[model samples]
Target: MLRDRLLQMLPEDDAAAESVEGLALTVTDLAPGDLGSWLADRAGQELGLDVAGRALQGGGDAWAVAIADESGTSVALDLATIDDADLEALGAWLADPAAPIAVHDAKTASHALHGRGLTLAGVAVDTLLAAYLCHPDQRTYDLGDLTVRYLQRELPTGVDAESDGMLDLGLDGDHSGARTAAARAVAVRELAEPLRTDLASRGATALMAQVELPVLATLVGMERAGIAADVAYVEGLAGEFDAAVERAALGAYEAIGHEVNLGSPKQLQEVLFVELDMPKTRRTKTGWTTDADALADLFARTEHPFLGNLLAHREAIRLRQTVEGLLKSVAPDGRIHTTFQQTVAATGRLSSTDPNLQNIPIRTAEGYRIREGFVVGEGYEGLLTADYSQIEMRIMAHLSRDEGLIDAFRSGEDLHRYVGSRVFHVEPAEVTSAMRAKIKAMSYGLAYGLSAFGLSKQLGISAGEAKGLMDDYFDRFGGVRDYLTGVVDEARGEGWTSTILGRRRYLPDLTSDNRQRREMAERMALNAPIQGSAADVVKVAMIGVTGELERRGLASRLLLQVHDELVLEVAPGEREEVTDLVRTQMGAAAALEVPLDVSVGFGRSWRDAGH
Candidate 1:
């Protein structure tokens, strides 16, 4: 067993070298951070350790085993079986501030250790973090899977082990945890080096080490502080939405001149196309389209009462689902603890699960009512939401270096109004609301490579007019057109596109023979950089905001991050300071030609703060 473990840990060297080579290493009894971890063992280099096993195996606050870097088997300690005095004596030398440790889930183990009244000095190499930095596209980074992929080593299949999420050491098998811990430590030590080197090569070391790792602690705190949900309020909102749904369905029935299944798509299709004899929409697999977009188009064209009520019904149903979801996910503490996933999106955007907070709507009046349920918790002063203003457009201006766009931003005038004036050759103040709306649609639409037909459909303008408007807008912001075209051209040549932070997205479809696929890929290629860069800036802003809050020794806590917006739970007597800190940190997060503007508001609820 010892020989095999040595061979696995020290792949380059033979078992004979291990027999002669050992460390005069000292380790303190494992302090904090022992949920699960791995140590990188350097024979003659600075000392490190790897740990794994139950967080509290055998009712103790320690790992099953603690192994020093490459010499896992030769100098492995069974921490679970060891006496307290022996562990403490063993720890005396390991307590050297210079010795660093590596961990998989940094917070899980670190928080666990902190709970157990133990702590480790020096940095811990995070294997999970390292893997993410090396290749963000990989879906899962499970330890067992990564051990096989990276090290080509399978975990030992022990007796009756790995059942119901617990690995069973033989009934009296005391050394199983130690063995698993030692092996994991060895695997992590092996994987950490190459990942670090890869991150450094790509200039992502600072992003991973400085930005991501440190933010892990703050993220853990935010998850723990989960935005308090007013259960009764959410329940009431659900009831209201349900009642609205019934009213909408009844109105649809009245509009259609008879009772029908509003939920039945086929019935709606028959009524829309056969009974009503409306204009035929695009075909689908089942029949002519009855989807929301098609229905919306029908409503726009015919001012159909049925279509309007159906749309309202659908919205009410969706809002009701959101309210019910929030109520279902409320924890014992009266909060909704969403799991924020860092690596879900290709663009480095964080995604929320377990009742997604990001999907909440705010465009409608009732939507605001739902948001009101996410009120300030007991003992918290109020909620403060700070959001980036026109972030993506700002990014587009910066990326394209369009003088017109940048000047519009710098002018401190209304952006849509300014763009409208240029497009219409009118004075900024003379730009009518209709003109500004068209320009606003085009400005945002163009960034995503929106077609004239799509723009016409969205703005209810003729295709010719939409195309002419786009031409006029681009005529003024030629830099933007050129930049957008250049992004696709470069991606076609290179087979991938990258964000400002060097986060790359591969686009092989750019060279595909299929024109549809190629065009879609081009749009993706254009949007990825702008959207991804904006995402990167927000991530940086989050790190900075959290760090700044920590630096100022404030009691305010960040509760939720919804894309461009962050909702902070302000402590009493600290609202003003928190608001300033939030704006300063977010504004300074990224350096662009145009400034990153932050708009902050505070109120008793998210809705008020959001306004």
Candidate 2:
């Protein structure tokens, strides 16, 4: 029999003892159909058992196991009819420590055998949980995928619930259950040691044990605490957006002297650059200059009514589309469940999936209307948002320890004004708005791999003038320039860069032979430390805030996280306490020379929380 063959495959000492002593098996309903078939096939192929003749009998529950003798002889034993002697014998076999116990279905087995007077433990070590805990980067839970990655062979599918035979062999046609079981068992057995090793090596074993694991338990809680939306506010704003889009569409058609799809970048590129003879700004993968920045520049250069109108048209249509998309994606319970992806970005920032709440437009007035769609939840008094002010710059200053930059922040002087004054060789008060604007552009541009040509295109100045401006800026802030160069050099030397908390980001391309590729890698290397450190600070703050709330038994819940901001759904009368808690936790999450400044706002809607 298959059971006897399995026993014989075990060591003689263990096999002989387990054969004399019967074993108990329990399966879970969530077990896939291929599990039984895969096991049967493996037994037949590897252990020389003919399990095809031992098909299970009539409509068995999703999970079942039979007790048998050492020689694979059937034992007529029922759980309800078994005496203490049988139960003790079965428990002893299970507790033997030598006989390896295999569990097929985890969930069903846990439920069925609970309090059955059998100490068949070990279900607590779940394969799915272990996989997620080990590699949070993977997005799916399919067992077949897990098996294909960890094991070499393909397993079977589906279960045979209706067949009747003594040994309860799986049907050839249904192998999904067998495959799933095998996958789970293999994953469970294989992953345990490696996961522990990785956790220990990363020094995140304690973090995982104390913080991440518990936070997972609270995900459903936060989801259930879904934020209230202003249905009427969203509906009214959506209607207004629709009307505005129509008007913009008409204006765009009027400017072009014909109707065209404003949403189609291809058509726009042809009309603007090819037909209209407008200068091409940049080339996209599809040989187009229809990118947002390029279009804005094209509008500025030509002063073409059509180009300006088209830009406006695109923005309006995009806002309308975003609103419509959000309305459709909202759950039936009126809560938006934006999935938090833990490891998508190379820089280690968390990304939002589904509707992607992180990308909700906020820079322009038209795009800002979408925020009104996120209303205060029922019984919740308001939505409170807090953001780090110039966090990346602060992080850069802290990491570089550039005295000038640190002093600029320490003296409570305006950062852009300081840069403008230094670059223009003027007193801080004499720095004009134009000077400040140029400095502001340069400050942000440097982080994005800006070149003299790119700056000339942006500022509408001669390339010589842009080059001079860059030279002046670097001369005034030599330490900042040197620090930026040093960061890239250090990354190239180490093969990776780490944030304050030891969060590492590999940058293998930093030493690439391709000039463009190497420069791009250098930019990322420079930016990742600043951005990633900020992200690490925020994550720590989130964990700290969650712990504080739970400790105090507060009802407020964290609802969303943007790159540098966090949104909390506040309970009635708890806004003040929650706000204080959040500010304290976030600001102290990291220590920097320039103190981390946090700005807080609250209102019945996201729009209201803007100020």
Candidate 3:
């Protein structure tokens, strides 16, 4: 009857018609007393689960779970009405590691369950992550979309078919929500094998199981145990930045001899190009451009006081906004819980949102001041930060197998200094700071596919000089040049690139007739493995660090992961041991031709630890 209902709900397409041909669908409501017996009978069996909730952050008070077992039998449980004993039993069943379970987004489900005083485990497959691994280029992997793409049928909308003038399975009352959740659970179950096979084909099965799945738990811990914030300090910083913004605006108006809206690009454009008779920037359909780079360049050429004040105003405004966001994000518990997104970046990188802590500046004075607001929690002795130094370059060395670069890393001298000495034909000690600076730019720039023009713009040198510098560096490091060229050729031949961990990033535009698109893909090809490998390395390190911390029964816990750095709260009397444990775990996260160098720091606040 349910199969027939599905058929009537979906459109009359051949694929949809065939989807329900041999399948049996069943839905049942198990009373609270029946839950224990049902879970016992389903022990060691694979199950598909779906959670209905308002959001993942707090797992709204009214949340239920739909589960599908092996016999195509689906059941829905309303946790709100379940007794304490039944809820505890259900939590134990969900947390049983021996039981295999499949879910669309295990992280979300886990977070929701966590919010409801439960824990989710035994997640054999996360269909959402699997879909991402299979099709890394897709922007979204929504369940309904994946169901249509894989199962060839539209997911059920959970309305009583008879009431909605569609096929109904002799059902009535407020059973729609349970029925819809059960349908989704079944969809997730059906999608598991297909997505698993796709991941196997892409050679990312281990990446999913070993790195992504395990890291899901670690991320939930970090999000729930969000770093503590100094509320008074943050509010003070916000007020200070607001005053600074006003001052900068006043300076801008004073320079122009008139009060104009500093935030208005049109007004600024009129003041810059027309009233002041300054050279116009690149023209757009509306008017001349007034972007940050254009304004900076204009200031460089003319040294205009107004441009200076305007740039200062923008910077102050941005800092003020960032501080204000942090202030607003402080939860009632005095911490900022950022949401970590795993599938957003194609390169296997993790991104954070809802007051993104990762995008916080780390190089500016104001940035340092802002970080000072993230203080160690009350019970924590201090904060510890461990960062990888020149990790990308080291990865490049391993990938390229360039003896010159490898030897430089192994020689125990500064990387840029050693390369500078070789490029300038001087001893390492004789390499001047300016020479090392140029070499540093060129070395890191090559990994990013930086062209001569781009390098010149970055270093403020002539294009010819930049070109000559690159050529000279390549001549000294022939293996690096050959490896860079060969990576593109190999990716073009294979139609994808693989990181050190064998994570593939498919690039179909490699063969495009459009030169711009093809060249852009080529740049991506060059950078993908390097950046992606770095990401993989960090993920592995996070897993290892957390695993070791748990195994050793340490009280210290991981707080945040931003790029190549990991921040942790040091437990009282555990600082030295935790510091050593982190260094050992992170340093050995990946093995390559070059050693992974980790730098460790500690203090009362994130800023002090980082510095």
Candidate 4:
């Protein structure tokens, strides 16, 4: 075991000599005693650690530790071969919050450790998150990329070192995995200084410490305690959706007066454009597009039954696929564990993947049934969902400080109805539903930087009408228009827009030479603060709610976070308590011009829990 572990941890002497020719570090395999010695040497100092694990959320297979001291040494420990005593000691050291350490993707590392019956703590810096804070515009924050970008060095590979002082350890297949892991640990160690410095310089240190890191831990808990699934229910829903797909497909074929592959875009195009003699939609390289929007537009113009049936077929197919995905994702423990991605969305919103519960439809009756597939487990009484109503609009009111918008919320009237009355020049009680709908659309659209033409397309109105409506809205709420313009202007000058919590989103393209790119960046700038602030508030609420759950000794646990909503599984007797706790914590998560209205519901399944 020792020999095998050594072979995994260190390269052969000749290979090491040739591989690290220009490198300044020594490589060593950590024997049992070396663990203590290296840790003792680095006590009261910052270090970097990485774990090679079975799965991202599974047990660790090996571990590496690198210190940034002048010694320039990194030690590798194979978890599989390490003595039981050493492993326990390692776990203790890991859980010690006093021991400062940095790692890439600390949540994954924490999950990996958790699978081994260990806990990970003391992660003072998650380089992945720090890099995200530094460069949120980037698509990825891979360790290799971070190492090259921040540390000005490439991670070691099996290839030999370049003569020009770049570090490379000529790792062979026998030891490449372990040696590479060690190299990443070293890179993470070296990255700490520049990354932390960048974060501090950006005034994002508190955002990282107070919001991101704690949310990381909270997410780890939520992912581990995945929501329970009704496997039988999901399987049944899949069948129903499949039937619906077939029925819609048949209906489409009958309407077209012939059978065609509903799944084929070419066939769809032939039927709609050539056979049915419908107007040509947007032209694509392959042909005219048969996408949902184009088809919907065609249907609106001609009221073609074929197009309607085609749209229904597409919807059924989508629902069926989602249900099938849910069925496949059911774990052996009879639950679906979704990975909440923190770094994906630039606005800091948490996204669900691996059978995304967040994407489950809510508005349509068929879509709502899919939520019924997620049920409370045997030990729980039911599911309780609490969500903030009109969170983004509320955020917009707070940020813009528009007196009309602010007063609209404070008046305890329907926001859209009140705004509609003002925009259409009617008394509040006399506002028509149609007028309120337009007001609601315009209000939310402004936050998204929606243009008049885009609003016209969405609401089936003329461009002139849409523009006039927007003019009226701005007239009534000039403060909002001014705030939006100022947000873009300030971002243009400063190269970044800031959230309520001082989280900056850099938009260098605000000064771009290209009109398209600059305008797009302007839209992003306008939306970032409102959307990002909502995300920040939700995160703060998650942290507070999770903390209070423990503080108050509640058995109900948070199952998932879907945008502005939180789903929790209530203990047999704890539904009322959990509801109160969630409402209080979530409503008080952030202070704004308007009260954060929380709607709570309880049900046996997720669908019924909707408020």
Best by lDDT: 3
Which whole-number lDDT from 0 to 100 does residue 551 have in model 1? 85
TM-score of each: 0.82, 0.73, 0.92, 0.91
lDDT of 1 by residue, 1-611 (tens): 33443344443533323322332111222233221222222323433344443442233343433444555432445443444554454354344446555666564554444434445434446777767766666778776777777767674434232343233222241434334444555666666776678778767777776667766666667776789988887888899999999999999999978998877888888899999999999998988888888998899999989999999999999898889889988887788878777656766777898879888889888787888898999998999999998999999999999999999899989899988898899999899999988988888897789999999999888999988998998899899999999999999998778888787777789999999999999999999999889888888888888888888898889989888999999999999899888999899988998988999999998888886
Instruction: Show pairs that collide, candidate 4.
Output: none
Clashes of 3: 0
Off by over 4 Å in 1: 1-68, 73-99, 107-125, 155-171, 174-185, 250-267, 274-278, 299-308
Could you tell me which 10 consecutive residues in candidate 3 have the lowest summed lDDT?
Answer: 161-170
Estimate the TM-score for candidate 4.
Answer: 0.91
Model 3 agreement with the true structure over 69-146: per-residue lDDT tens digits: 765656655655556766787789888877789998787778667766888877899988888889988979988899
Indicate the TM-score of model 3.
Answer: 0.92
**In candidate 1, what residue range of length 10 has the lowest lDDT sum?**
23-32
Cα lDDT for residue 486, candidate 4: 96
lDDT of each: 0.73, 0.63, 0.84, 0.80
Q: Show pairs that collide, candidate 3.
A: none
Report the C-alpha displacement of residue 343, candidate 4, in angstroms. 1.1
Question: In model 4, where do residues sit more than 4 Å from their true spots?
Answer: 1-12, 16-37, 56-70, 159-174, 283-286, 300-304
Q: What is the lDDT of residue 421 in candidate 1?
A: 90
